[model samples]
Target: MKIPGSSLVRFPGNDPKLMLQMPSGGRQNTENSQLITAATVCLVVFGILAIVDGVYYHDIKYKLYQDKESILEHIYHTVRAVMFPIMMYCLFAHDFGGVLMIVGIGAVSIDFIMLIFDVKEEGRSRNRYGGLSNDEYMNHVFANTFHFVAIALILAAKPAAAWTIDPSFALGRPYPQVTAWLGSAFVAGGVIAALLHFWQWSQYFSRKVAQS
Candidate 1:
C-alpha cells in the first residue's frame, strides 16, 4: 500500500534511501516521463513526415496538379502546407494552451473534413487523369488516416499541455501580449484560409457554368 504522503520507489530491490530521496512534485515530477518524451519525439517525427507528405504526396505521387487543380484541392493543400510547420512550432517551441489548443484542434478537424472534399474532387477528375493506382490510393488514404490518429494520440498523451494558457490572457491585450496576440493570429489565419477555399470554389463553379 502507498503511504499517505510518501512515494513508492523500487529499484531492483527495496532501498529506504531511494524512497527517502524521491521528490514530491505530483504531475510536475512526471513532466519528463518516458511516455511524454516518447510522445514528443513521435510528434516531431510525424511533423517531419507531414512536411514531406505535404510537398510530394499531393502533386508528385497523386498527380493532383497534373490537370487544372480543383479549388477544393488547392485550398486544402494551401491550409495544410501552412499549418504543418506551425503545428511543429506548437509542439516544440510555443506549447500553447487553452484557447489556442481549442483553435488548433478545431482547425485540424476542419482540415480533415476538407480532405474529404479533396478526395471527392480527385474522383471527379479521374476522367481527366485516369483512375488512381493502387499505390496512389493507399498513400492518400494512409496520409489522411494517420494524421487523425496522430492528432488524437498527441492530445491524449499531453492533456496538461493542451490548456496551459488561461482565458484571462485573451482579455485586455495589446500588440505585444504574447499568447493573446499569437492566438489571435492563429485564429485569423484559420478563418482566412477557410474563406479562401470557399471563394475559390465559387469562382471554380462560376467558370464551370460559363463553360457549359
Candidate 2:
C-alpha cells in the first residue's frame, strides 16, 4: 500500500501552487499544511513569551542589563536578536530550497547552540537575585517548549528534497496576513533588542568611566 503524496517532487519557481504535490496531480498533502500551521502557532506563542521574559522580567523587573554577571547572557540574546528575523523568514515567510534550505538549517542550529549556552549561563547570571524566580523560570520552560516544537514541525513539514533541489528563495505566504504580522513583529523585536543592547553597553562604559 503506497502512501499518497509520499513521493515528493519539486515545483519550479515561486508559484503559490508549487508546494509538495503528488505525481499524478492528485490531492495535495494536507499533512504539510497542518504541520506548518501548527508550527506557526507555536512560534507566535514563543515570541510573546520571549518578549515577556526578556523585556518584562529580565530588563524591567531585574535590570539584568546593569549586572556584569549577566553580560554573557545578554550577549547570547544579542546574537539571537540578529538571527531572529532571518530564521523567521526562512522558516515561515519564505520557502527555501537547496543551498538556501541548508543555510536556514545551519542558522537554526546555531540559534539552538546559543540557547543552550544562555540557559547554562543563567545560573551564574541570576545568582545575585537568588536564582531564577518561579515566574521567570516557568516562562522559560514554556518558551523553550514552543520554540523546540515549532522547529520540529517545520522540519517535518518540509520535503527532504528541499535541502538539495531546485535552489530557490521564494515568497511562501502560507498565511499572508499572519506572516506579515509576524514579520513586522519580529523586525520590531530585533530593532528593540539592538537598541537595548546598545543601552546596556553604554551604561557599562559609563560605569567604568565613573569608577576610573
Per-model TM-score versus the true fold: 0.53, 0.79
Lowest summed lDDT window (length 10), candidate 2: 20-29
Which stretches of model 1 miss by more than 4 angstroms?
1-35, 38-53, 61-63, 69-71, 160-165, 168-212
Q: Write the per-residue lDDT of candidate 2 for residues 23-129, one digit (tens) a residue.
A: 23223346676777788799889989988988898788988667788877888877776776667656666655555556667778888898999989999999988
Clashing pairs in 1: 98-163
Candidate 1's TM-score reads 0.53
lDDT for model 1: 0.49
lDDT of 1 by residue, 5-122 (tens): 5554333343332222233566744543434444444444554554455456554555443335444566666666456435433432343445555666666766666677767876
Clash pairs (backbone) in predicted model 2: none
